[model samples]
Target chain A: MCELLGMSANTPTDLCFSFTGLTQRGGNTGPHKDGWGVAFYEGKGVRLFHDPQPSCSSPIAELVQSYPIKSKTAICHIRQANVGEICLANTHPFVRERWGRYWVFAHNGQIANFSRQPGPCEPVGDTDSENIFCDLMNRIHHTLPRDAMPEQLAAVLVELAEEYAAQGVFNCLLSNGQWLFTYCSTKLASITRRAPFGPAQLKDADVTVDFEAETTPNDVVSIIATEPLTSDEAWDVYQPGEWKLWECGEVIASGKRQR
Target chain B: MCELLGMSANTPTDLCFSFTGLTQRGGNTGPHKDGWGVAFYEGKGVRLFHDPQPSCSSPIAELVQSYPIKSKTAICHIRQANVGEICLANTHPFVRERWGRYWVFAHNGQIANFSRQPGPCEPVGDTDSENIFCDLMNRIHHTLPRDAMPEQLAAVLVELAEEYAAQGVFNCLLSNGQWLFTYCSTKLASITRRAPFGPAQLKDADVTVDFEAETTPNDVVSIIATEPLTSDEAWDVYQPGEWKLWECGEVIASGKRQR
Candidate 1:
């Protein structure tokens, strides 16, 4: 299985610390290393960095860890290649433009026997994850109105997630720069850091960062991952069929469905 | 105005040498200091690197110059920002997937008062270049069949390029990994290097490269840019209304029209 990471912040914030922890799992602490990619949402624009090499040794990953590219919402994935070959096209997270906005998506788990009809949003690579992402985009393009709000969009997303989860695991993180929508079919966890931010130690690497020193009191930052990245932080684990819509580092709407 | 760079090769080749020269014009040698982006096509997959910062001093540009990411086709742009603001969203070359293939595009000239009807393929940023790109995609999506060959696509592209050129400047480089199609409304130049390659000196920077030492005899590499990147090489300048379709570093079809 692949590992997923996401972040939502009230202010533009960097994912250097969390990303460093996740990169360690990509090839060092864990074996989830076939390729890795990250998408950082800067306004309506997204900066994507994809490397087919293992994250642990990728020069691109090193640059990502060292550079402080601030973003309001970001999605990242470290792949272990259960379905697709190791190539730049098959690397997650995948991005597609919809409704004059960029939608970035990253999937962690697999969907057995997944198939979909070709649509406007076609997959350039032969990955089940990308196939489903294109499927979701096609559904949204055909069903949803152009000006659909987050709540209305989430309703459709939740419905699709439930159906996808029934087929197999469907844990995913999606964002359109404005909001982040995460769904959990098997494993997912998140932590929100606000005013009383404290120093946190990484579970995967010998790295620690004092959130208090880097963040302001009013700054709110939330991080979501397939597993909790920090050792000390109290992460909220998601139930099997849970979905949440996040904006400005807060969960605006959330629900759990029994699969 | 912006500086455009594109490459088409019979085999996988790195743009490090050419890119280094173009980047110098991003700020140090020219006025195009707004933003810069590059897309390297590895099969159907295109690895993109975008930065709103000026390429001459951008850290990401440094990495691109140093890393040898081999690709058969590539498109790059360094913007001066006339129709759009200097932001990540407006950076080029822009990318979208069509017919299960990634289409990468970069524009050098401006399109004044460019507008388009919204379609499935939309622009995430508000730029005249991106607006025209979406319009082109929409036209191809609606008019052309999914299985249309390169020639059929080029027929449609040449028509649209002529229409857009009538309004304002429309020098562009577009590729779908398989073939590269370039249209020149005002300024464009190209050079193809093969077996008997000699040493070349950069026009923009103090950099010299011995292509004879680096390339194989069978390798045919073609480079397209707004102007000749090297001082020593003789570049073929495009006429005002000229278009060419390139594959395997060779111009398979080319034509010129009087506007």
Candidate 2:
């Protein structure tokens, strides 16, 4: 299994504090340390940093932690390598362009006996995770219109998540720089920080941050992870086969399907 | 105009020496201070770094120069905006997947009044260079099979280059990691180093490298740029209507057309 981290915000926000906590699980506090990657959505552009090294020791990950890259949406993952070899080619998260927009996807957990037809967008790596991403793209490209609304796309995405969850674990995070989408088949959690936010301490790392000092009252920042990253804050845990569409740090649409 | 830097090597090599010289042109030594990007291929995966800030002073570029990310092939560019705004989306060395292989492209010249029909692949940025790349991919997708050979792709590539060159300038370098294809519309130079390699001095930056000490006798390395990066090395200058197919640092096929 692997760890996933995601953030959606109303304004440009940096994930230094949250990312610092998550990096601990990559090698320090957990066993999910094989490779790590993060993608920060900067308007229509994405600043992606991928390291095929354990995040705790990766120099690139350290740079990312030390550097404050502000973005509206961000997705990160730390892998443990269950289905693929430990190499740069199989590292997450994977990115491809669809309808002139870059689509980024990262998966956690494994799909046993997973197989699919070759799609218009093919997987660069041999991982079942990348294969699922390509399959999803193939379906979306055929089903959605060139200018499909995010809400309209959410229905198909929910259906796809349910179908994949039926086959196996399908927890994943996806984004197109405009909106963020998440599906949880096994494990997922989230916490939204807004006005009246208090101090929160990381569960894995000995670090704490006060949201009151860091944000304005109107600022909305929501973080999603494989598990609750901070101990003090109450995280909203997702039920099995739950999916959500997020924009501007708020869930625009959400549902849970019994698989 | 922009400055391009590429490498094709028989063995995995680092582009720190050539990249350092190119970085100087991003702001310090040349007029191309708009943006810079580089793509390093590790097996089937590509590590891409893009910064809209000038490379000479960009912190990300500094890390890239300081850290040695070795690769068998690399494509880099420093852009002086002509048809697009100074932003990450418009940065050169753009990447996309075609038939499971990531295709990287960078252009040094402008295309005046260039337009093309939309295709399977699309550009996230509004640059003539990206449009040309998209058009090239559309044509290739329609005309070639998924497993087209590099040599077979070369013929169509040359034709596309000529068609784009007819509009204006179209100096560009493209690679699918397996092979490199270069088209010179105005200015491009290449230097291939093997045994008996001596010291080389950068033309723009105050730096020198002894290739004899750095490379093995059997190592074959080729560096291509908008201009000869080194003042002491003998570079093969490409004519206005010339194209070459390179693999393992050797030119397998070459041709020219009267314009």
Candidate 3:
């Protein structure tokens, strides 16, 4: 299986610790050693780093590990290459511009028989994940106005996610520089750190970080991943068919449809 | 004025030495110190690195100089910020997706009163360069088919460049992973190296590279820039309003529209 890691924070925060833990799965602690990519949203612009090489040994991944690029929102993925060939074009997270904003997305689960031609948006690589993303973008372009409210956007996204989940596993994390949207078809987990931040130890690696030393009291930082990155932290697991809309590290809306 | 650096090669070639010279101009040597960006096309995939910080001191730029990310086509720019603020969104080279291909572009000149709103293609960055690119993409979408021939596309691009040049300086480089299109409204130079490759010394920095050590006999590598990068090599200068289409390190089509 692939792995995903996302962050939504009120203040600009670095993802070095969480990313280090997640990268371990890309050839070390986990079996997802195909390729890895990450996107950091800095205002309306985004910085993306993608490597077709395994994250465990990639020089670019090492640069990302050491470089402290702070961002309010981030999305990352380590691929196991189930649907697409192992190539640079197929690596995620994929980014496309829409409504004058760069929209970033990463997926962990796969859908079966998911063949759809692109409309206004197109998939450069032959990935079912990218195909699904293009389909979603096309639907959004046709179904909603450019000035749609965030809630309205989330509602449409939920409907799309539900339909994809009905097809197969459809865990995903999406962001458009303003907010984050997470959907769990099978498995996903999240944790928020605020006020009394504490030390946390990675379950896959031998690293420990004291969040209090890196953040202030009023900082609200939320992290979502395929699994709890830290064994000590109390991660809130998302049930199947669960979706959440997060803004400024706070969950503004959430729902779960019984399947 | 900003500087432009581009490469279209028959083989996957690294731009470390040339890029090192360009980085010096980003702050140390020349005055294009506001921002810098580069795009490397690998197959249908693109590896893009943009930094609002000056390239002379950017850690990401340092990695690019030493990491050896080879590609067949490359476009790079060091911005001096003529019409936009020094932010990530305003940095070049800007990227957009059209007809399922990622098109990378960079401009060394500026445009005046370029306020054409985006159509299906939007500009995430608020730069005159990006706005002009968005306008060009909109026109291309409206003017051509997805399967338009390369020459047909170049013809349309030339008309657009001529129109933009009438507004202001319009020297630029563009690529869609297949061929490189270079438009010279004011200044541009190019050199093609093949068998019996010799040493070349950079004019902006104290660096010399022996092409024979880094390449094979059949290798044909062409480089295009706003000015001659190497003081020792004889670079063919382009006339004002001259445009060239390069594929596999060779010029396929070229014309100069006398202003």
- Candidate ranking under DockQ, highest first, comes to 1, 3, 2
- lDDT digits (tens) for residues B1-259 of candidate 2: 9999999999998999999999999889998899999999999999989988999998888889878898888999999999989988899898999888999999988888678777888999989999889999888889888788777788889998898988999899999989989999999999999999899999988899998888899999999999999998889999889898888889988899964
Q: What is candidate 1's lDDT per residue for B1-259, written digit by digit as tens?
A: 9989999999999999999999999899998999999999987888999999999999999999998999999999999999878899999999888889988889878777888876778888989999999999888888899887878888888999999888889999998889999999999999999989899999988999999999999999999999999999999999989999999899988889854
- What are the DockQ scores of the candidates, in order? 0.83, 0.77, 0.77
| Maximum-lDDT candidate | 1
Residue B196, candidate 1: alpha-carbon lDDT = 91
What docking class should model 3 receive?
Answer: medium
lDDT of each: 0.92, 0.90, 0.91
TM-score of chain A of each: 0.98, 0.98, 0.98
Tell how far residue A185 is off in model 2, in angstroms. Answer: 0.3
Reference-based lDDT, residue B34, model 2: 96
Over the stretch A1-259, how does candidate 3's per-residue lDDT look in tens digits? 6999999999999999999999999999998899999999888888889888899888988889889999999999999999879988999999888889998988888887897755878999989899899999888989989888888998999999999988888999998989899999999999999988899999988999999999999999999999999999889999999999998899988999865
RMSD of each: 1.1, 1.3, 1.1
Clashes of 2: 0
Ranked by DockQ, the better of candidates 1 and 3 is: 1
Worst 10 residues of 3 chain B by lDDT: B109-118
State residue B226's C-alpha deviation in candidate 2, in Å.
0.4
